[model samples]
Target chain A: MHKTLWREIKKEKNYLLAGKPVPRLLILNAGSRNHLIRCFLKSWAEQGEIIVSDSYPLAPSLYEDCRSFIIPFYKHKNYTEAILDLCEKQKVTGVLSLIDPDLSILSELKTEFASAGILAFISEEWIVKATFDKWEMFKVFEANHIPTVKSWADLSEFLNDVKNGKAGYPIMVKPREGSGSRGLHYIESEETLISVWNNAIEPMLIQRWIEGRELGADLYFDIYSGELIEFFIKEKLKMRAGETDKSVSLRDEKAENLLKRLSRNLALYGPIDVDLFITAHDDYLISEINPRFGGGYPHAYACEADYPGLILQNMQGKHLTEQKIKWQSGHYMMKFFDMVFIDDKTRRNAGEEIKQQEEN
Target chain B: MHKTLWREIKKEKNYLLAGKPVPRLLILNAGSRNHLIRCFLKSWAEQGEIIVSDSYPLAPSLYEDCRSFIIPFYKHKNYTEAILDLCEKQKVTGVLSLIDPDLSILSELKTEFASAGILAFISEEWIVKATFDKWEMFKVFEANHIPTVKSWADLSEFLNDVKNGKAGYPIMVKPREGSGSRGLHYIESEETLISVWNNAIEPMLIQRWIEGRELGADLYFDIYSGELIEFFIKEKLKMRAGETDKSVSLRDEKAENLLKRLSRNLALYGPIDVDLFITAHDDYLISEINPRFGGGYPHAYACEADYPGLILQNMQGKHLTEQKIKWQSGHYMMKFFDMVFIDDKTRRNAGEEIKQQEEN
Candidate 1:
């Protein structure tokens, strides 16, 4: 073990006794995680020293004055060790990630970080697995009494439903494990479904089309207390690149009730992002729940549901109050393209660094 | 006058005494106006016999088992005469249009339709002019106390605002009389602003960008009763070709209030579509209003805020009821591409029809 790791383990015993605030936060895969960076810089900068790590130097350039680490991508074998080493050296007290792949990796090693006196703001491994795996998430939905769109794992089942008039034409067929809008196909008829079925990636899911509005709920649970602390719902006004590019925050009574019910059941720590559709029949049918911060979190934050502030307060041994989660409604977010200019030399340097990191 | 026209004039006065519902609905430019046709076919088909007319034959073929007329495009000099002739011959009582350019033409001849005892679902000429002319619409917003983005017609005035920080960088510069998202440029700096200013169309308006969610309000006013009957607000969730491709219906008090205020103030006696943005401060900034059936109105219709029902009921001389406008909230509409198949012979025939109409 590294010297700092062993030393941190020794200090882990006295951390509670000393009643010290968390000294630093390690934000993993900070490149392109602009929403996370904005929240941290805007709300939580005073709480702790923010250290962001990405595989490329250009990723760090997005920040003005924050610390940056050009660490290897999370896919590398040495990635976990590098994060651990960085945590030990910088006295990183809280570790969290914004990327999807890093969620599971960091989650599985939650205990390791805890042993070194650092809190990893990730859900349990099982929860992470359940979230990313669509079929498993569907099972969770059923167990929780959450209304979800009718889905089929096999094509024959879908065809049977159509034949029986239980489900009509214009069924949705997509890869079961896909994220965002990738591999999504709206099959309009039996002929179209039959033609696309074989070409679709295996382990696909066909779902009954829910004709209604799509709403996204950004949620937070206290890591220390394991209680739901924040709930913010937005009607997705527009989407681009599978992320909410335009959204308006609204307070829907049924959606809020659903969120409260889901929080009571899931009992997971940290932020949970939810995707759901309000059907023509006025039922909230949850499509998926992601066990991480969502791209639309900024909309929630702008509404004054400051999850970062909640997390930071909890990190310092504070508990959530009813007042913390209250937010202004009717606020909206319209995302526009922004640019970060870099010279040719700096761009080339960042490219070379990425290449070198991959080789390593 | 034509003999048919003279006969229709006599029959027109007796329509109320005869108590016959509109015998036929002539939906003009029915081709490519799929959303409008869908609403009419789904909701109003029982009310009247549907007669869809388009310059191209293929346009009307999308409707299964309905009457179709290969009329000349409305811009054609004899277009109004042709429609009047069709109304006389077919015993059509309702003449509404779906295309943009045809709106003014129909509205201008609203009295002519009334003389024939046909109801034309169009706004007054002044309303159409105010909606399409951006500068005039801004003046209306100003007069109504509706919060609108600051705009400048002169480049020097815009530059002064930028200098004073009233407007920041990345301001939108576009043609003063433009529609859709065409000719809109986001100028980030003085250099870029100067570069694009010369290339931009004459008589441009430079306005501050509203950094928030875009909202589309679908509204209806009873032409007979002269009262606002239906209102549905949708957050523009996605855009394609400068039109709302996907949207979710939302019920916001402020947005609703704004729509009500606009409706009460303007009193356009037809479906009035309003576009606005909910800013970061939760202000509803009115952008523009279209005095016609908006492209995104189907989303609202799907939510059960049946403006079509309101219109159809009023066409039968029924007054607005509260129950007619009641809707389920949280409903969304995700638009998908649908195909209308035309064989080679049908397509060629449609082409020949369009060419003949153009030549005429």
Candidate 2:
């Protein structure tokens, strides 16, 4: 597989040297209205062309320009088949997935693509699995000498350590695959820890919570070449229900250096969100690696970094030139507001009651 | 357009927060691919799913299971139309282009996608034009305090200066839109310069040929935010017919720093190949900016840096993380070899000729 990939790279290089133009790209999405995917899609659009698909009828209308397709049956039934059908029908040049559940299926398909001489860009299955599993990723980081938060997989061992005062309180507990802070709790005492552990059905990883709002850098690396290509840092302001409410782009040379070190140590490829805890010691402890594009991608884009464009270039086997990104260092908040509509009858009743109160 | 883009970013963010799955992406290329685009595609694929377009008809045989289509028309016809038609017919979620001519057209189509909330990435048009045009890009760099080789637009002026001993000979001359060193010549005297200038039909830019072999850096930046993302330095091993015979990837902190300074001064976007001359004084003079993906991207990829992934992540509005790339410093060369087939009769004839010569 590696040899084939290398051959493709060589071919791409030869064609480029020959002054032949590169081909256009197309993106495929199962979910029509995902903000993160949309950001990537937009980035891809900057480079070539795009199309969208939604198995759900009420899919968001944001991707209106992309030819939207309805595949309600494909959602729960045979997603792979559905995708295959789409590929055959649309003459899709490539396929990319943005979610975890799709990884294995994509990996399987990647093998097929490889056999067909079509390039399927699924990460090494082992790497994806290891990174997705927090414990596995930590092991890799530890082996590579990448600094990370102290974590324990077994609750009993963790509790024992805490009882002995080796592990302190105020640690965090959450499911291994959970997204957004779901079912996560801060345990300040043994009793709370036990209670939370009992209530949490999903397997969990325990760690000492890093003190500070989440500050992260999303980095891209070439897995084959082990080269760092681009990076962005964000100070997460508000995270509600596992989503950041407000965040701002920041510049820190130290943070950048640290991330660079970690990327090299991990032999990272693709998008990795390195969670960090800035502590009183003025140091950063690696939290976790979200092995995909993060929600704050727009901040990078708005900052004038065309990361999406970079990815496209890399896949096509081209070199990146030095770029100047215009990052705005100011408060940028993403707040969610809910809209509620009241009927005319309710409005009139409420108005009458207010009027009566005022008259009295 | 910016407002709409923000809205889409927010929407995508919400989806990620809600734990909705993202989609897969596909990248296509005809020749040497864009490193930035490839990196981003890989990044997206790491988290989601990805497929790359195949230029050869037999490529489908290589990548059978993954989604891919053969759009032979893209090679020779209107690339934009071919891409759009493919996207519409295939239900692709997004589109991207990593090369020059495609970027301009993609920028124009970004709005069409935006109106429908379909994610389309388009860098600033003026930036694109300025950076792609070698002469204009140099002008921008100079105006912005970016250091470059002293150049002259008028050949007569340059010749006069050289004849007067104000400038040295063996200068480099190139056409504005020329690629792969085509039509580029080294003129050592006023007579040679005059003859070449008069015969050249295209507007040309002339610069003192720095006494150094070609060395370049593939760098990425957030053009909107002005943040330096990723970079790598490389040395050209050989050149033939305007293409490198062997391009090797290297790591140099000093070169990276110089490229960073240049990027900051230029406020560049997309793919940028900055050529530099390491002077006797240890000062690096900027040669030019490609403003698109260069042919040497595979070297970086071989070194494990995924630049294309970074661009895609940025376009998706995700935060970029810092990644450290560990480069293999041994002499790596991309050598070109041609494959030819001969029938048994031809082989026998060749063998007989050899036998006759030996007998003689």
Listed for each candidate, the true contacts retained, as a fraction, are 0.00, 0.00
Docking class of 1: incorrect
DockQ metric for all predictions? 0.01, 0.01
Model 2 chain B: weakest 10-residue lDDT segment is B335-344
What is candidate 2's lDDT per residue for A266-328, written digit by digit as tens?
A: 545555667877776787767777655655565566655666666677656666543454564
Candidate 2 regions exceeding 4 Å error are: A1-47, A71-77, A223-226, A264-267, A319-328, A331-360, B1-360
Write model 1 residue lDDT over A1-360, tens digit each, in one string: 112234335445544455675456778876656655767768975546566677755463333345556777777888888788877766788888878999889889999988988888988788788887777887888888888888888778777877898888778888888887888899788888888888775678788878999999988888876677778998886665566655667788888888777764675788889898999998888888888888778777776788888777766767775554566555645553222323335445445544544455
Q: lDDT value for candidate 2?
A: 0.57
Worst 10 residues of 2 chain A by lDDT: A335-344
Model 2: residue B322 alpha-carbon error in angstroms: 60
Each prediction's whole-model lDDT (CA)? 0.72, 0.57
* Chain A TM per candidate, in order of listing: 0.87, 0.76
